[model samples]
Target chain A: MNPLDKPYAQLALAVLAVLVLPLFLKSGILATEILIFAMVVAACNLLLGYTGLLSFGQGIFFGIGTYAAGICLTRWQIPVPVVLASAAVLGAATATLVGWLSIRRQGVYFVMLTLAFSQLFYFVAYTFSGVTGGDNGLLGVPRPSVGGTALNAPWSYYTYVAVCFVAVFAILVMVTQSTFGRTLLAIRENEGRAAAIGFPTKLFKLEAFAISGAVTAFGGALHAMLIGVAPLSNIEYHTSELILIMTIIGGSSSLFGSVLGAGFYLLLADALSTVWPRWLLLLGLVLVTVALFLQRGLWGLVERGYDLVFRRERAPETPAEEH
Target chain B: MTDIALQTRGLGVKYGNFHALAEVDLQIRRNSVHSIIGPNGACKTTLFHALTGRVRASSGRIELDGRDITDTSDDDRVRLGIARSFQVTSLFPNLALRENLRLAAQGRTPWQALAPWRRAEANAEALAIADEVIERLALAPVSNRLAGELSHGQQRRLEVGMAMAARPRVILLDEPTSGMGIDDIEAMKQLIRDLGRDHTVLFIEHNMGIVMNISDMVTVMRLGRKLVEGPPAQVRDDPEVQRAYLGNMITGDIA
Candidate 1:
């Protein structure tokens, strides 16, 4: 059996990545962002990879979390734990509503519904300047203090985000190993058969959405703290696209693939943006290459490497049967 | 009557102006192998769809153990003891054969199906049912293989096994032997014969030999209506059934 198939092995890799990022990168802030996005992207994978729902409304939950953190921290100075919890709850509530409405349709129509919801949310945040601070966003968000000392340094705050990242990653891993996760995969494979076998597939899909929304929101709140501001861009359509792109580039087959995708995209952007202003064009070329050659993303490459090194023989592919 | 495991009255399904099935009445007896047979486009599959709630009936009602379940959702119908396999094989192609069976076994308990904290392997009851199904279907050799990797015969048997995993009182199998060789057909025939001992098995088939050999009762259909229904020997001998369906096939097989 592949070592990566084990949950403990995957978790250990996550811990290793968290420990190693600081050693290679000079910017603690960028390292923290990779961890935050990793959690959010993995949440997206629960829908896209496991449940086969290509949701575009993940940014809605993520943005809601940012606003939750922004409003609570800037105005009320609520405890960090409470603020984080509220962000997750609000994200879940919003996701439930969106998932319920969007899942009423399937295929392209479902994708359209989520995209429309993303736009609607963006406008709501934009129009409600009184609460969301309109274009300026809600600024002056403070990082949580540990004991009596404030995590004023970027590296100190990276430690805080790293702990949350591990917890969230483990929870997501647990969910995928559970019966619910297996059912989600079943639904992804054949929903009609699942329903015939007596599984309420729609409810399961909605529950996946809820979990994805909660995790994405938690990541959003962390991002707000990482930057010390909840920007309006956090809720935009572009944010949804970026998260989806990372999910695709990393591969959806495994949870760790999500981390690889987030890290790869961010690190690539950081490197290219400094050297060339036309970095997006280069990114487009990368996307095409991934789509054409690396369909399973970076994780597929890693799996191929592992197979070559250890097994020296290709795993047998399941022969397709004609209908 | 309690002897009737499943019953449908005045069942009809319409798509726009076309009537796929009309005025179809069926009474499937308890613990009998009931087979529905017809020529192509005879609405045989349409009847199974209406019975299993895959397609809405424009008129009339369906009952399970004499209880009205005309408005029940498709998934709820499975919980209410009606499970069905598709005309086209529809197992979860990406999942292992064991996991596919386990999902079906776990379907009866929806609350536990949503247990996110507990591992899927922890559901001992479901695991046991899956293992029993694998053994019963003689799929133990390839239990760990992906469903998509199975041959047409194995997939067909797996299709029936998945429905059986639900432990449903009424099992509806659509074309359980649509595409099988001689040996596969023999195995499936014996499997269906055994299934009738415990389950009220309703199946659709084109294999006249297997149908006549195993079915306790048979319903012949033609162009969205029931042509005739009786014990296999009686149905085969009926002039209307011979003219509409059985024709030379029945005589060819018996002779």
Candidate 2:
């Protein structure tokens, strides 16, 4: 099934409207959290599923983004827009440099280099005692404010985060639907074939990775603005793992699946950890079950189910018969 | 009358200690069906690779039309109207047959060096070319079939369709009818003959009957060097050709 053909634009607007309704319900805090996490997972999806290159270091960009904003707000007294934009650009440039080196290898080597780079970023952020506050992290990251209005209330802050998610998501979708998107899809199908047929497969992969890194950092910056904190925990490999699992459980190939997975998995983990405190075992168990049974994740599974239920609904006709 | 499509001067290629294509020189005429015929490992494929810029020559210059492109990459050669079909089926298995053809056609549209594909009138024209190829190749019925799902002969046809969709002036085919059945072989022969009207075709074929019946000229290679070149009838009757093919049976009227 052509997953990209799904009505993402219309559905994105619909989801945005539904999320805004939470502002009225006063559940905007949870809704904003869901939207932010969705964008992070969606950023990871840009490289992982679309370009077919998996990195274990996506959290570096996310953490860096958050820290960029967090440090700027607390120390530099930078505005939220500049902070977010600068963080994203910085992350993108960092990603480009990493890509220039890491892209020379493929498969396990690619994973290893990205992981190494992520760890390097983590240590840099961790050891900076004066600026990053070291283990304590920077505090008093002022709430993100627009031109005149300070988004101090949960409802107002959530609205801002929600709007950011919608815009980033729409752009990502445009990228996926454009000529760049089709070329990446070709690269994903078979890198060697794509190269043989005049496509610069390696260059495409690197550019895509850089784009993913930048987007992830943007999401991270926004998250820092929302929570008013940027701690060492945000950039760890475990954070990267969490986003990967979110992509897996919600259907990695589908953009919406990433969001759904982020919501379901994170919200579930958040609740379970508060109650049981050792929900890692349960989380691991759930991941194992999903991998074993429903490999495509919930959305893909639902999509397959839809196809099966509607068998009479215009089967894709084979052109071979016409020949 | 002195039109030259290709000219190779001392074209030599070495793989480690082995000389795959020794110092060889040849001129292929423009608008002619030139066939390269030889036994296994006679450097026929190597010559084709050299022509298409897939392999580097050890120390030689290769001129296409009138320009030197010895150091040009395969992709650049493709843009310069030298398109090729691999000896084996090279169509993308994941994509539909038409999509594969579309990709081939889309390569014709030039764009900024690092930019992704641009939507030129070329894209629509590419689709139109794909439709024409599908119809001409008798692939219209199987045009929507996944390339992997096609029968071996159909896949071979699709491979040719992919190369043809480029609208190249020069088409390099390596055994286009290698594994086809008699009926499919005939169809392929007919298609190649039809292509000869508009393209400068250079193919490698072991099937002597197909070569003599279709090729205007034949270049025979042996032991990594060009042994002879002439009209098919003349080359077929050469004593050296008979000795090369039949070993010691160069007897009587056969030679």
Q: Model 1, range B1-255, lDDT digits (tens) per residue?
A: 599999989888998999998888999999999999888899988898888888888998999999998899888988889888888999999899999999999998877878789889888999999999999988888888889988889999999999999999999989998888888888898899999999999999888888888888999888998878999889988887777665776742532
Each model's lDDT: 0.92, 0.78
Residue A154 lDDT in model 1? 93
lDDT of 2 by residue, A33-127 (tens): 77888888887887888888787778988888988988888887877789889999988887888888898998999989988988888888888
Model 1, runs deviating above 4 Å: A313-323, B252-255
Q: lDDT: which candidate is best? A: 1
TM-score (chain B) for candidate 2 is 0.91
Q: How close to the true structure is residue B136 of candidate 2, measured as C-alpha lDDT? A: 94
**Clashing residue pairs found in predicted model 1:** none
Each candidate's fnat, listed in order, reads 0.84, 0.25
